[model samples]
Target: MIIRTAMAQINTTVGDLEGNKKIILSSIDSARSAGAGILLFPELTITGYPPEDLLLHTGFLRDNIRVLKEVEAYTTGSDTMVVVGFVDFSLEIYNAAAIIQNGEIKGVYRKMNLPNYSVFDERRYFTPGSRPLIIMSGSLKIGVNICEDIWVPAGPTNDQAIAGANLILNLSASPFTSTKNLTRMSLLQTRAMEYSCCMLYCNHVGGQDELVFDGRSTAIMPDGHRIVARSFEEDFLVIDIDTDQSTRYNLLEGKRKGYCKKAEVEEINVIIPQRKHQEFLPEETYRVSSEEDDLIDSLVLGLRDYTKKNGFKKVVLGLSGGMDSSLVAALAVKALGKENVIGVMMPSRITSDESKKDAVELAKNLGIETFEIPIESVFDSINGLMRPVFSDRTHDVTEENFQARIRGIILMGLSNKFGWLVLATGNKSEMATGYATLYGDMAGGLAILKDLYKTQIYRIAKRINEQTGTEIIPRNVFLKAPTAELREGQKDQDSLPPYEILDGILRLYIEESFSLDEIVSKGFDRETVEYVLRLLQRSEYKRKQGAPGIKVSKRAFGKDWRMPITNKYRD
Candidate 1:
């Protein structure tokens, strides 16, 4: 009556079928060696999570099925029942999981709920599945469902449970967003207690472009005891659960809930051969990571994967001695090693001595190579070239932007000559309000802090220093006024409100989706709120052109925010 289950919390690249196949096969062998009765893999194990437009290709779909078949062959003669996710195209494409045992696919459970909110766009590609699946393995009746299915009420889990399922297995590719892991575990615990069954959840780990999946795959027993895998990394978790200990039969008195009739559920029977396996006590412990730890780890993983997956071994960033650039440098060093990170100081006449010293000190502390490419001569040449057309025009924001563009050209030039990936240091607040000069400071392959607000950037910067046990980010960088140094004595607060106030309004307007009046009502000045919203609306075009960055918030600018550039209506 005891069942051993294993979950492979693995990292997969989108569209890398051959590579994913190797990982999946190795995981299957490991799970079989562990003597697991059932093994679960993350959703979209073949094609990787959120394959996006690649799913539209007919050949890709066939190739995914081919990989699944290949994996199925590896499970031949093994007692472990493998449930791995893949794309299924019967009449139409469906997000599905194949149940394989003894080299044969017992059943395929198509994901019933296709999420279409925020970062998820599954409904656009996948047709909704109607049938709820249950696997009858000896005395254990386990319900199988995909990510969104378990999140929604009255979904496949409920139907399968009503039809006498005592254990629920979920294969997920849920992306990291601040404290989503805690919320996910709480949901699983609630479901386990409600159904008087154990909830086994497996999630994808590592970064895919902007999305970083924290693979804290977990199991919640009916008694609320929890067992978890590694956080923000690949981990193989194996655990045992006694079917006799489940309270489902006692709660239902050996009768079905009748909410879903026996005929309504599609059942597959698999006979797992009883074998002598080593018994180990389940580690009923979950690693509870703080928001700071999760944030830093998510950023590092996202940056590392993005760089390596894109075929870039080294990264270069313009070090302005500001908080944003310094943090990005530290992250790049951590992700790609200090030898691969090159910090360039493109100082102009307006750049402060303190800024120059701060940038050098930071590079030294991080043990990174530094280059001081002063842009004064380049700025003069650009001005001389422009003075003919602008002989009568007065010096204004145009001159300030010229300096920024000159520095941008320098960074891009270094990137081209040395083949270094340029990292943009602009944060969410600057990206939101039109505070960044287009084609200037925003010129990079990836924007490290694109989705983070200015205040959040400061907090993260402080936390990095604390975690490293040294001032790698430089102590003076934290106290100095945040400035682009585009002009003499140009502080960010001069153009915009204080970060504390600006971030407060932005959190309400952007993330919380509050109206101008609504934000103003929440202890903010009406004029300031209106101005900030207007700036945000004006900056839509710039954000659309910027590089994609890690999404660690409830709503990021890339996939989540979809504002129009030619809109006339004002909030």
Candidate 2:
């Protein structure tokens, strides 16, 4: 028998219940028109994923339930079976998927495995479910599970298969990291083959706060044949799966012996209307995006959704003509239109002639406005006033930081007067080593490149130029050494190690979680590793106050890496 399944990979904003409901209803209509018998949505489609503390509010849960009812009402006169994720409250809340057929609730599958590590605290909000839910549609025994339920090898999927489930529907809100999509696909294919069942994986897409979900949803046949949806965007994927394929690999009867008591499957029977069998199109594999391309897309979408969702139309950033600021400006143009981005060249006395020219050239190439604001007078006044407090101390980092603060004030001033959001351009290398000033370069409403390393920044800059087919980011910008221009002849390498070395050390320490000895063992100088570690530990406060950024890496400074500000444990 052939069954048509619709994977509704959609983008959802957190706490927008009515808007989310409207999108769901519209997707339902679209899926029904496409003649899909089973319609599946992402995890927590009603309230949005990681609703966080919003789940604590009683009214939020009630409103979600009301919205689910409204969605159930949509299926009243139709034969489409809607399986959508929402909050189900009994004595406590559950991350659940409600199965609806012909205006009636068939079953609710509470997510059994609540993820608690690294940007997930689902256990804090939800109680663990003990039983597996299987819904019988005609001859098809379809098992329902949430995001984390399918991750475990011996979890609900195994139990459901033992209880005569031939197909599993997994609704997920899995966030996008560099290698996460590939890893997720591998796991899904393995589960489908091992359980001898076709698996439908529907994932959330779009940006919500720091998390960006790339909806590369999939349908894996029992024989490991698969079809994938589009990445980093919403897609309605309708495909036909052969139900007879599961009969070839039955679960051993003894496999159900120990699980008989705790793994009793709750079964619900619904009459699946037999519709005309359309020709099943050949399943197409999604084109895999390069890591650099994926990073660029994630940043662009994250910035776009953050600004538009927060009610900001335009964004402003200081353009030093350096690699960091130039990349941020280009991204802003990509996220918002060129007209919506403003590049302010806040040049100090030490600013290079080339820097000023490059800034103008980049703005022109990008078709954005540029403002040259010379801060010499502001610097002179602040320096004179601070000379007395310094007691004739030689010009040091203090004076250098004053220059950055002056530029910060200018950017913030423009932000206030014109209602533009300020975008900080500091990369992960600087943020890791406390290379940014607290109220100076770090002062912004959002940090666009906070999670990208300095080396990765240059790679993306080159990729942008390559894709645009023109020198949008000036050629000189790539040739010039990266500098803050806070002092005369200032270069980033003068204060910190070379970016190649520094970023390598940082990747091991921050992303890889390598200790000082392990990092030093990897051919890095011991002293350099120790110094980088020291700086990273000391910079916790600055990162804590820094603006939120898009997370494209496995671990970002935002919610994933939680280090104490006062911790003294050094390795």
Off by over 4 Å in 2: 249-262, 275-278
TM-score of each: 0.97, 0.97
The residue-by-residue lDDT of candidate 2 on 1-571, one tens digit each, is 6787788999888999999999999999997897778999999999998899999999999999999999998888888889999999979999999999888888888899999998999989999887899888778888999988999877898888887788899999999998788799889888887778889999999998898998999988777888898888789998877776776644432323354334688889887655456466465685678888999998998999899888899999998888899999998998899999999998877988999999989999999988889899999999888778888689988888998888899999999999999999998999999999989999999898999999999999999998899989999999989888887788898989999999999999888888899999999999998888889999999999998988989899999989999998888
Local accuracy of candidate 1 as per-residue lDDT tens digits, 248-289: 444655433445444488889998644344374466778787
RMSD of each: 1.7, 2.1
